[model samples]
Each structure stands twice: as C-alpha cells, then as structure tokens.
Target: MDLLSIKDPSFLKKLSIKDLELLSKDIRKFLIENLSITGGHIGPNLGVVELTIALHRCFNSPKDKILWDVGHQSYVHKILTGRASHFSTLRKYKGLCGFPKRGESEHDVWETGHSSTSLSAAMGMAIARDLKKEKSFIVPVIGDGALTGGMALEALNHIGHEKKDMIVVLNDNEMSIAPNVGALHNVLGRLRTAGKYQWAKDELEMLLKRIPAVGGRVAATAERIKDSLKYLLVSGIFFEELGFTYLGPVDGHNLENLIENLNYAKKTEGPVLLHVITKKGKGYKPAESDKVGTWHGTGPYKIETGVIIKPENTAPAWSSLVSETVRRLAREDERIVAITPAMPVGSKLEGFASEFPDRMYDVGIAEQHAATVAAGLATQHMKPFLAIYSTFLQRAYDQVVHDICRQNLNVFIGIDRAGLVGADGETHQGVFDIAFLRHIPNIVLMMPKDENEGQHMVYTAIKYDDGPIAMRFPRGNGYGVPMDKELKEIPIGTWEILREGEDAAILTFGTTIPMAMEAASELEALGYSVRVINARFIKPLDEEMLTQLFEEKIPVLTIEEAVLHGGFGSSILEFAHSHQYFETVIDCLGIPDQFIEHGGVNELLCDIGLTSEKVVEKVLTLTREKQKRV
Candidate 1:
C-alpha cells in the first residue's frame, strides 16, 4: 500500500506480470478514493492504469521518452513515477498539476493539455535523439479520438514519410470527451479487425514453411503468398503505404500481451503504429455505463452511487437553451444542420442530435475541418450552425478567415463557454473570441444579454443570408429571465443602453453586463450616477449613441472579459481619436496581459480585479484623475 516507500520502475520491473496487474487494481482504487475529494480526472486516469504500468515496465522512461496526448490520463503515470504520496493534492492550486507538468518530473518528457499534439511533440524529441545518435525509443501514446485532429494527422503523415525512429501507441478507447468520429475512427476499426486475422494467418504460414522438401523457391513463393495475403486481408495499409511499419491492435488490458507487443516494436526500426484497444472507465461501474456523457471528466462524486455533488440549481444552462431553441427552429427548416468538433455532450447538442440525427455532425476533435465543412455546407445554401467553445475556435482561425469569411457564406457559429471557464485553467478559458473574431472582416459578432436575447440572436443569424455570424454566450445559466415562443431579431451593429446618467458611461457586452450593472449601482450609491450601456454587438460600433455620449462631455469606461489590447475598449479609444473628442476622458477595464491561474470563477475574478468592487474602484480613480487634469 505504501507505494512510495517501494522503489519506482525498479520495483515494478521486479514484479511478475500478475503482480503488476494486482498493482493496477490498487492504483485504480487509490485514484477513486483520492480523486473523489480532489475532483481530478478520475475516469481517464482509471482507464489508463494498466497501460501505464505496462509502459513503465517495458520502456526505460526518462531515457526512453513517453509522451501522453491530452495529458489528462497522466495521473497514473505520475503516481507510478514516484509522486504517489502527492496524489491527495492533485489539481489543487500549486500542489500538483491536473495535466503532465515538465517541471513536476523528468519522467514526464512532454507537457500537454490540448488534444492531438502528442505526435508532433514526439517527432521533435525523436529527431533530437537521432541527431545525438542516441538509441532511445520515442513513444507517443495517442488516443483514438485525438487522432481525428488535423495536427495529429499532419504529424502522422510527416513522421511516416520521413521514416523517423519513433513508435506511436494508438490507445483506442473509442471516445474523446464524446465518442470518436471522422475517417480516422473508421480506419482504426478496420485495422483492429485486420490485426485479429493477420496474426492467425502468419502462424499458419510458418507451419507450412516447416514442411521440408517444399522446394526452396516454392518456400520463397509461399512466403510471398503469405505477405500478399496480409495486404489483401488488411485494408488499413494507410499507415504502411505512408512508410511506417504497422504493428498492432493489441490487448491493452492484458499485461503479457502488451509487454510482448511493445518489446517487439521497441526492437523494430522506423516509425511504427501499435493499435491497442481500451475502455474509457475500465474498472468503475458507474463510469463504464456513462455513455450519455457524464463520466468523461467529472466533478466531485460519491464513489458508491457516482452521483455528482456540485451546487445544483434548476435555472436553464445557456448550452441547453441554445440547443433546445435551435432544435425547435430546425423542426420546420430542413436546411438547418448542427455541427461540433467532437462535443455533442459538452455543448448540449444531444437534443438536436436526437431530433435531427441526419442533420447533426460530430466531427471529432477537428476544429479546422468542422469550420471548413460548415463553410462548404453554407455554400450549398444550407444554414450550418457550428457549435464550438471559444477557446477551441482559436485552433481554426485560418479556416474562419480563408474558408468561411473570404467566401462570405451564411454560417452561424455558436460560441459557447465564451468567458473564463473555471478549474480547467488558462488552456481552457474561452476569453479571447471577441478580441480575435471582432477584427476579422466579413464576420458579424454578437453576444446576448440573457437567454431571450440569445434565442433571438440565433433566429437572426439563420434568417440573415448575408455572411458568417457568431453569437457568444457564457458557460453557466442565464439571469433567470423568462423565455418567449415568438422570436424577434435585434438590429446588427447596434447597442441598447440599459441605464442612463450624465457623469460617466460604462460600456460592456455579454455576461459582464451584469457585473457592469452591479458596479454602476454601487457607484450611484456613492453619488457617481454612472451610465450603463449594453454593447451587445462587439464588432460594428453603435456610433449614434456613442457620439451623443461624447457630446455630453462625460467620461467613458469600457468593460469586457477579454484581453484589453485589440478589444472593445480599444475600438472606443480609436473612435474617440478619429472624432477628435480628446477633451472627453476614456478608460478601459479588463484582464491584464498575463495568463490567469486555476481557481473558482468568482475567486479568479476578484484576484484579477474584475469584480464589481474592482470596477467601482476603477470608476472612482478615473473620476479623480479627470478632476486633477482640470
């Protein structure tokens, strides 16, 4: 039980394969117990326990590189590599990282969080080793779903063609957040079936070769016949044709089989593909049965019932509202189609998928392909709604610019999780879309004040056959506003003033509108009487109202949850300079030029001075500065 007291891979290396299997069970139990309290990635870590054990036993890590793609499954790797004692502090602030941290241990050769990047990083490490003439094996453990990403495929093509000395361990878990999709998933299925038959036929041919007096040339012909049989039976010559040696569809759970196969691959030359099948939640009952999208990544849950215990409220989440409304609209409209880059469950598109199964497409971890495909669908005059997280959308910027915007097609981009997503940290925050998407030409961007406005915006986007449009909404629920059946479209490139005052103005968009309101109310109590305007449309300026505000000679304060540079605040300043309203004071409040760390959403906001209290302080400071100038 005292895993750290024992030596690491040295001790693991001494154990028999059966003992290692027992240790795998212990690791799973330990992960379940500790992660129940810490709320780390329990399901993924549990699933990869046996695989991690087999990997360490066979490969000499810290010498032979092992890179884990998407890194959430690295918990077992960390525990095995002498951090078992620190398991209690996993995902805690400054305690231990949820993903693989390069600084945490030398054994973790590469750090990763975003999916589909392991192969590329592995290739870099492999090339370095080769240049040094070091014979260390480079193995990248990539999941079946991660292979769907464009970057992973590109790396695969390059590595295969270049004939690099690397081994790709394809962990086919059949899921990635949601189930895997696209052509790669189909190819892996064929490879698994081919591997099952190929190994059997090879054994039969070896037996025939043992038959003496079958002439030397005949034996050579038989060997060629067997080789040809392999090519005929296996349709997945995709990797082989690309130049990499294909070697698997191994039993990932079976330690002996995995060890034998991995040992063989290690001795082989050039890039090799080892296909290994695994279950997402191998030992856990509740997680194993969670096909409806509950166990991929979970919060704190009861180990017995697997019931999630987060603070629950019945208010409709923004994802559900958007999906439900879209499904309702698509009931009559046949041209409407829904798409996500492998996030039907996370984006709450389950309703749409069920109702319009033929119309919905889950592209599987490929954001670039999703955008371009949506563009192609739009070209056919079919209204394609591309549902994606704001952060993930950053991955497909080129597609949005070249494929979608350049053509000026009718594509509705539903940007969900459009602000600070807590716990998952900097890599997962959806805070930069307004800053990035606003500047792109032929792109109309909008964010809703509440769920009602979100519905209206969805309707507006589908009806306007002009060009590409995106509507961003925050992660959680709305402001408890009532819904309506009849939808109405708000005018594009415009803003609605929520509250009016003469002393100063507070301009904002999306969820920050509530924060701005709270700050304005607090300022009013202090006799400041600040104006609060909801600038829903981030791109096109509401020039008519802004000009009148400038004429009033009142100071303007812009607030957003995005970066300050090249954001809404910057646009207001540019407008002020163009109109020569230098006499009117202008200020901006937003996230500073630094990556925010992981914490509770409210805690993070207060720490970064984005809270209502911070906003009030900013307003008072600006007012005093203006008076000092006078």
Candidate 2:
C-alpha cells in the first residue's frame, strides 16, 4: 500500500502518467484517512500530491536537492520518499513531524518551519554545489504567496545576478496561510488571468510555423510579439526583469503537464522559474471552499463533514482573546491598525479583519517588511500593532532593533505563541523571545498572567505611544479567568506581589505564574514561607521590587518558560553583580541549553524539572542546605 517502501526504485520510473494519476489518487485518499485520524496539514498536502509525484519522477532525490519552502506542503514528498507508513503517526508524540526534518529522511535536504527562508537556502546550496564542482540541480519550491517576502525578493536579486543553474518553482495556489496580501498578490492575480493571452500567442506561433523557411524567423519575431502581448495582459516585470527565464502557468494537478514542465526545466540551462498553478484542496470539497485557512493546520476532524472535533469545556484561546481585544480597541481608536506576517486565521485576526478590513494587514510571511512598515506607520503617529508568533518574530530581529527600537517607534508587537508550542517541536518553540528582546535597548517587553491580564496588556500597549512595546502571550487556552469589561492602563515597568514570605521570593511571568503559585503552596506545606511576585514587565525588570527582595535577605528564584541563557534570571544576576549583592542566591528555572523535543506542554515541562513538585523538592533541598550551613 505504501509506495515509499517499494524496494524496486525502477517501479516508479516504469510508471506511466496514467499510473502516476492513479497513484496520486491513492496518496490523496491515504493522506485524508491518516490526517482525519491524526491531525495535521490536510489541504496543502492533498493539493501537492501530483506535483510532488511529478517532481520525484523527473528529479533524482538525495542528488538533485528539491528544497520545500516552509515545509508545510512536504507531506506528499514524504509519502513518496520512504515515509508513507509513518503518515499514520503524523504530528503525534514520537511520530512523523508535520514539517520536513533533515534527520527524518535523506530526501529532505533542508528543515524549514517559518516561511520565505527557502530562496536564500536554495541559493546557498546552489553556490556550494558550484564551488564543489558537483552536478546537482538545486530546486526551491516556493509558494506564490511566499514571494511577497522582502528576503525572497533579495535572494531573487542575488540569484538572478549569479545566473546559477537553479530552478525556482513558483507553486501559485493564490493563497498563503490566508489569501495573500499587498501588491505582489495583486500582480499574481493578473498573471494568473494571462492564460487567455498565452493561448492566443500559442495559436499565433502555430500560424507563423506554417510559413516554411520564414517560419523559424517568424516564430522568433512572434515570440517578441507574445512578450509585448504578455505585458499587455499582466505585467510581471518583477520575475522577468530579475533575469530568471520564466516558464509556465502549468496545471500542477495534471501529472503529464507537471512532469513535462519539470523535465523541460531539468534540460534547460540557467536560472529557470517554473510557475505552476494548483488548488489548495484539490480533491476534498469541504477544504477547497475554506478561504479562511482553517484547513491549513488542523486537529482531528470528521471526514464526512468538515467539522473540527473540539473538546468541550476548553477555555478561550489566547489568540482569540488578542484578536477580539484588538477589535474592541480599534472600534474606539481609529489609529489602531492590526498586522500579521502571514497568519490571520492562526493569529485569530479574522474577527478584527471583519470589523475593520482596511485597518488590518496580512503581510504574507514577510516579518521584516511588517516590522519596518510598522516603523514607517509609527513615524506618522499611527498605532500599528504588529501581531506575530514569537518564533516568526526572530526573522525580523534586525529590523526591530534597527528600524523600530533605535527610533523609539510606537509599534505594539503582539507576540502570539510566546511559550512552548507542543508537537511542532524545537523549530517552533517560542522560548527565545525574552532572551533576545531583553538585550535590546529602548524597547519595553511585557507578559500577561492570563487572558484577562493579556487583554489589559493590549489596552496598555495601544495607549502607550511613547516607544515600542511587545506583549508576549502563550499558545492554547487561557486559565479560565474572566475578562474585564473596562480596559485598565497599568503603569509601565511595574510588578505586583501576590503573596508575602520573607524566606524566599519567587519571581515569575506569564503562564508560569500559576505554576509559581502551586510551587509556593507546596513549599509552604514543607514549612518554608515563600513570596510570589508577578514579574509583568521583563524589559523594565521591576527594579523597586528587586531592590526590596534583595534588602529583605530572601533567596530569590526566577522562573520563566523561556531559555535560561540571557533570560529573566540572567537579568537578575546582572543586577546583583552591578550592585555588589551576590550573597542572595538566585536560581533560574527554564528550558535547558539543549533543544527540547516534541511532546505535550505538561510532559515537556515536567521532563525539564519545571513542574511544581520538582520546584518544591528543589526549594526544600536548598533550604535544608542553607539551614545546615547556619
């Protein structure tokens, strides 16, 4: 049943286009059944089945590297490359990853999670191949929507000038995670409509060919005429002028056409751009109609109906809270413009978009451009809230530092998925933002305890027009805390002490606050009094609270769901060193130096000794050791 594990590689080579078509059907059906049982990317994988089959048929994998951009559409590639049996365990614990992992298979040349990095990577591989005098085709399969990224454009410029023998396959489905945004999407829309003009030109060529000796001369002249006509139909001066030999508006669903075009590109010389048009969800009717990107990444769903099976009694998700809160704020303040790099559905910004369409921007996986654009908007005094995942925000770190923080721009960066995102694993963990952002000057970074506090933090970020601020919030459901009706503007750089104890002070932020409370309760049972402080603002450091805790001779403990290096506790250590107060022992609790693997959040937390029971044990051990010394 699994084509991947078929021992005879010659079987794939012998398969006709008709056989491949049938195989595509089998792959689609298999993907549907497996993904329906175990939640994963259904729409993109189903759409790319034929395209992947055609590519592997034409190109030799492990020799000719086919780099998949973002790796979301790599399920078909995986299914074809000795991983079909693993599809049953997709996105589960100790199962096949949703994205392409290099260690998983030899065919997967690169690991990708975030968008728009493929072009640069492809270029690097191409240049490396050239340097080594190795004959391998470097093909980067990028989505039409991924072209909107500034980095992709930059890479295009370099690759165009280098004139390297690389293939850039533009898989144009007219959608990213959501329907694409900006001028690029508009340009693609016109280019997609140029099918009629292309047909006319093809007919004109056949007419010119009938002129015998003059046919060859007339065909060349007719090609120029077609080029002129192409300009008339839709202007793609973007790709054509970039020195890439533009080919196709080929049907990606058609195996014959895909194989032919791929073979054509393989035989061709330097820098080919093969544009293939595809449907997001080719076979599935329910997913095909989903324009909101709900089918992009999913949990277990009903195959008969397109209904997502949600567990009852789940709290309101943090993403929904942010989107709704932003919408409410925007209703009052017209200057509040919401921005996401590409994710509208993932970030739950559809509610805000529906209410204020013009004010919302889905920048199409261009985080750097979004940051700089927000900076530009801030110069004009517009309140631009750049909502992006913490991991994705890393892509635009330089832009944030140079364009935003340096200018002290009033951009509110609403960082979603701020903690451990389970299942997606190390590539997607949102644990590095605090460590990175804390070092940056003139930027205020804040975190919320729950959904209610997160809403208030949003209110705070929008109202504060002095400088750039980022509010980091975790993934999944909130702590069932009721949201406040009125927005409260808390003072900047302030923290609140929830409980009082002189023996030990527990400083924690965001989702870890509840864990700190639990740990403190356990410590109290062990006859050790513990103090709990909600360290709200990470950047500002709550200096007054720090000074008070230090003066009280209490042993300080910092807990955050971020990296231990250059993070919350590191700041405390830095403060202590500066003030010459090293006597008070401060222990940092967080993700270790090594990369954490995929699992449930709770499982990972306990494994890393961040659980309340572990914390309680550690505290008791430390206290007893201190007592013995006394």
Candidate 3:
C-alpha cells in the first residue's frame, strides 16, 4: 500500500481484482496528495488510474510498448514504473519531467508531449517489431480529442489498410483539454450509448435461425439483411469498415471490465480498436465536475477545498492583456475576428467569444486549418487574428508560408507563450518561433518590452495592411506597467532607445529587455557606458539605428530568449554583413543549440548563459575587442 516504495508493475500481475482495486484507490490518493503540492495534469492522471493498472496487469510494459498520446496522463504509468519517489521534483529544474521521457525508464518506450502522435509512433514500432520477428503487443492509448487530429486520422487510415497486429486503446472521456468538437466526437457520443447493439445482433441471429425451412435464396437474402442491420445498429462498424476488429465501450474504471476488454484486444488478429469509456477526473469532485477544462492541467491546489493557490495582486497574465486588447479592438472594428486551434481557455479568448461569438472561432486542434482559415478571412478583407501558442504554431508552418505569407494577406498572429514556458518542458517550449518565422517572407515579427507596449503592438499588428504580422508574448504575467488611455500604432522597422552610451549597444526585446537593462546598469557602475536598444521588430531591421551604430563604431551585443541560430541575433549579424559593416565588433547571447529541458524560465536562461551576467560579460568582451582594433 506504500505507493512511494513501488519499484515496478510486476507486482500488479499477481494481485487479484480486489487487490488491484485497492491499489487503484491508493494510486489516486497518492496522486491527489502529491500533485496538489507539485501541480500537474491531475484530471487526466486521475482518469487513467484504473485503466493504467489494468494495462500493467495485462501486458508486460518494457517488452510490450504502451505509447501514451500527449503523455500528460503518464503520471500513473510513471508511478507504477518506480517514479513515485520523484514526485516532489516533478517539473522542477533538472528533476522529474512532466511528460514521458525515454531516459527516465525503460518502461517509457516512447517520449511525447504533443497530442495525436502515439498512433504514428506505435505504427512505426509495430512495423519494426514485425521486421525483427519480435512477439510483443504495440498499444497506443489515444484520447477521443486526439483522434480528431489530422495526423491521427492519417495513421488510422494507414494502420487499418496494413492491418498491423496492435491494440489501439481509444480512451473516450469526451474531452481533450477543452470540450471536444466536430463530427468524430459526435460519432463517439453515439457509440458511448450503443451497448444495446450487441443484444440486437444476437436477437437478429436467433430470428434468422428460426427461419431454417425457407429456401436457400431467401436464407441468403435474410443473411444480407441481417448484415445491413448490423451496420446500421453498431456504431463501431465505422472502425470495422476500416479493417479493425471493434470491441467495447467498456468501463475504464472497472478493473474487471478493463482487464477483460484488454485481454480480448490483445488476442484479436490484426488491428483492434478497444473503445474504453472513462470519466475525466473520476475520483476528485472538483476536477470531475469541470466542464470547460480548467482542471485539465493545474497549479498547486488545496486538497480540502480544491481552491487553486495563486499569487495575490499580480500583474495581468500576458494572455489576458493580449486577448482583452484584441477584444477591445474588435468592438471598434467590425472586420476584426479571432481564431484559435481549440485553445479558447488557454488563449484567454472567452471575453472576446462572450462579446462577439460570431466573430470568435475555436477550430478544435487543427492548427493547419486554423492558419489557412485566417488566411482565407484575410483574403476576403476581414482582419483575422490567429491566436496560438509558439510551440503549436510549428504545426502550421507551411500554411503560414504558403497561404498567409505568400499571398501577402493582412493577418494578425498573436503568438502566446513565445519563450521559455517553465513547467511544460522542452516539447512545450516556445523558443523556436523566432527561428521558424523569421525566414518566412512577407511576415513581420516583433515582441514588446512590456504590457503597455504589447497592447500598442497588438494595435499595430491589426492595423498593418501590408502583410502578415505577429506579436509574441511570454507565458506568465506581464510587468505591472502604466497603461495609456489610447492604443497607437508603432512604426515598423524601428527600435526604441531605452538608454544611451558610447562604449557599446545592447539590442534586445520582450522578456530579455529587463536583463539587458540590468547588465547595462552594472556595466555603467564599472565605468562602461553601454547603450540599450529595444529591438522590438525582429524582421525588417532598424536600418537607421543600425547605420548610426555602425557610423559611431559602437560595439554591439544582441540578446534574445530564443534559439541562437536563425534568430534575431542571427538577423543582426546578417544585417551587419550586408551593410559593409564587416569590421564592427559583435557578439550574441541566447539559448544554446540544444533542447532546453524542464526547469524554471530563469534557471533555463541561466543554464544557457542568457542572464544579465552573461550579457555584461559579452558587452565587456565586445568592447574590449573594439578597443584592441582601435
């Protein structure tokens, strides 16, 4: 019963159903208590406790690969695989990861953070297993919401065509982050209540047997009619048509039912879709009652009252500032519309949706479609604001280039969580947006120094009719800066001078601005007059200011909270080389060429040498080089 001492899931196979049920309760209690302190995907993990136990009991994990889609619900899997002892350090700096990691344990066969990837990964592993003549099951536990993704659908088609021997556990909880939408969700809804279809089929077979005295022609016709009736009555026939043996709308929480259905799926030939119905946040009332998906992922909360523990009197969240600004602008401009890829809650677009439901659209996890939809709106002279996270925007890169950028449409992209999202780790980090979006033509990229400027930038982006423009903001709260009564447009290709000095210039924007200022002040104390420039516009380099720096022969140091390669700093280097400023001393500071792991934003920055100390050192080095050349 001591969950912390659990070494592996081998003990699960020996336990009786009653013992397993008790263990499931213990697991839930452990998760509720531990995650309340550490904070995690509580609802998802709670939902999967019994199912995960059933899985471990049914299959040998390290041998039989159990790939988890999105990996958020892997906490139970982690605990069973001897990771319960690491709960205290979950999502902390260089500690236990929030998602499945290949290095964490051999049981974690595949690492994933994004949704709808497990099916494809499972297919590949299944193929490899067949090639090597290995005898182990390939199970990919996918959510109903994830099943709607374009990638998942594509995988479903391919796996069905190939008829690979794998068990596809369709975890139907009727939610994915937010309440699921679209036609597939509707079909699953019908299937959830189709338990009587099996009984109907049996009765039909008995009635057919009673007509044995009929001619062969009539018997064959009756058989055909019964088959047609089966298709009409059974909701899982859709998957059956795709070459999969359809089983269950089994109760996921019931260990006996789960074990029975899982065993059936394992024994079935070719691909089998085992539809298991589950309740999201099964044991916890607060999470169970959650309708809008607020409890899907959460911060630390009180176990007694379920009240989220939050810092008091903090600045507005960056998402709220941006979304509210867009909402405010939408009141004045009828042409302005908002779109998100099933992130209405995360993007903080509820205000806009409440005010103008017709103008707000949640496209339901289809990033590619959302991008092209925005482009389509832009082509019709409608100003569409595509609100998306930096990491997810990677899914729509082609749409951004081909539809929005190539057509030169006026699309406003609000890139939220633009840099170093703390808890979600490498897969969810927003560091690569600058590199990915910078090289795309007809796209103007910028980040604001503070929330006040952020609102202004939002205005500027919506008003810019030339082409696609994006304003990226960080994950957490904005700096509590004063607000202006009216929003105004900032000129494109311009940088703001925060401080003036003669020794060197520090160019940076967004979350890195404060560090640059601190570094400059520290340098001033040491008798180095370092100028600080807010390089707000990442694309279309500030030609006038850059030329002034080159003419003055000021050594330059660029800082960014993004990848160093093909980022803002790289753009600066390209500018200097193109402008015949070959002799200018330049240095750059940013995230190194590696995937930053799970940690606090500050800690990750420190690890990569993007802190003020690094900035000061770089400034000292660049100025010293300039002095040596002089």
The per-model lDDT (C-alpha) reads 0.85, 0.85, 0.91
lDDT of 2: 0.85
- Per-residue lDDT of model 1, residues 488-591, tens digit only: 88888889889987778899988888899998999999999898998998878889988999988788899988888888899999999999998888889888
Better of 2 and 3 by TM-score: 3
Clashing pairs in 2: none
lDDT of 3 by residue, 96-152 (tens): 999999999999998988888999999999999999999999999999988888999
Model 1, residue 47: distance off in Å is 1.7
- Candidate 1 local lDDT, residue 387: 95
Worst 10 residues of 2 by lDDT: 1-10
Cα-based lDDT at residue 385, candidate 1: 93
Of the two candidates 1 and 3, the one with more favorable lDDT, higher being better, is 3
Clashing residue pairs for model 1: none
Provide the TM-score for each candidate, comma-separated. 0.94, 0.94, 0.97
Question: Which residue segments of model 1 deviate by more than 4 Å?
Answer: 3-8, 195-226, 232-235
Q: Which candidate is the best by TM-score?
A: 3
Model 2 stretches with alpha carbons more than 4 Å out: 7-10, 196-237
